[model samples]
Target: MFWTGPLVTALILQFISLGGGQNNDPDVLLESSFPPAEPSLMNLNAICLHGSGRARYPASFFPPSGYAYARRAGKAVNRLEAWFSQCCYEEGAKGHGQILCCAKQAWEAALSHFCTEEFSTMTMAHECCQQRGEDRWNCFAKQAPNPSYQSLPGYLAPEVPPDRIVFTWDPYTC
Candidate 1:
């Protein structure tokens, strides 16, 4: 279990590297490599779950701007994976600023994935209708598909070791 984190991260980085130097920009190459699904499931936040079944952060806190970005640029799959890896890592870290920085980068990268016109249209299509801002975003993320386990032909899913995948959010947080 202890070794799974590095292993999974290595596997994903390896997979991403296999594309060669087709495009210098990792973001562009990633977008082109994995096209968006119809209606798009990329807007979901990838939260890390501890063994005790507690979430590292409030599940509904972050924005789905990442998903919106991926969809518009036609790179939903890879972008989603990036967010998942980052958030999952944050779960094991202790610094608040670092975690927030990662989350911010995740959102910004997704937002800047493509042109403005594309971003606006895609975002509007998926805008949270009933729930207010954060609530709506949370619902979207919660309902969004988990890309970590998303079935893709010819692609191996990450092996989440039981113990490593589960842990108390903070053993000392009374």
Candidate 2:
């Protein structure tokens, strides 16, 4: 309980900085006066995820809102997804095994994603989960630790809603 205040403050500061699209309302004035992107879908997803995660997971332990943590996690997930997508695109571009470069990129991106500060230990814990590959996310899910699995009031599970909305993150430890 003592730790909750600081964490909530941190989250709130992050939430405001990210400019949560006004309940996702497009008409809201920009709090930070930063311009929005036009064609970058990834950027848009990143923004939305940051806001959504903050809105949904404003627990006492984790910062209530933060672009720093949210953006970091979001980018890691995005990079991992992009790498996997690139592998498919490469498969289409040439033929299976022809795009070794893309395959390498995918593997490396997956590794980098796993190595992020938030997920490194968890990735190490989940020996079977690769940064990419068919069962990667599933494997990571299996490695989630104790409190995360407790089904407590504010705990977030590795299983995010919208099953299609997969993440490359370990469950929040705190």
Candidate 3:
């Protein structure tokens, strides 16, 4: 778990390292707001969830000033992750390492969803949208929906033990 603690801290730092900081709320920072869904589950519930779970603090949240909003939002996410790490660590209890691992797994999973090649391409679209109108582009500049506790592939998916995979909670006892 100690490994996980440093690993998460490092990841968060790395995320922040990629961009400059802009004052914003970090707690509300979310990688993606889209919930995971099965291809077969295209039902009303899924649609409803999809509509309701759109990204928070989307680029639309900013004024139609310029790309400053996107830059600022990115920075805010970094700051949020940093703050989340500090606060969660403080409240991580006796098994702080385990908690770190959980958070790390969650973060990695979240990153995986948004930082993919497809997502990278979206950057171009976002930029183009910005050119069209910062206000309009803001609508497109949103983080993907967050991965749920049960939907994190790295954590929730079955895998071999003893390897560097996510740890699950044992229900029988603490």
Say which candidate scores most in TM-score. Answer: 1
What overall lDDT goes with each candidate model? 0.35, 0.33, 0.32
Q: lDDT winner among the candidates?
A: 1
Runs of candidate 2 exceeding 4 Å displacement: 1-67, 90-108, 119-174
Query: Tens digits of per-residue lDDT for model 1 on 62-159?
Result: 23334344334333333433454554474554454444445444433443343333535634533433455456445444443322333323334333
* Candidate with more favorable, higher lDDT: 2 or 3: 2
- TM-score comparison, 1 vs 2, better candidate: 1
Ranking by lDDT: 1, 2, 3
lDDT of 1 at 140: 40
Model 2 residue 118 CA deviation in Å: 3.2
lDDT comparing candidate 3 with the true structure: 0.32
**Model 3 weakest lDDT span, ten residues long:** 152-161
lDDT of 3 by residue, 106-151 (tens): 4333333233322445244333233333433233323223322112
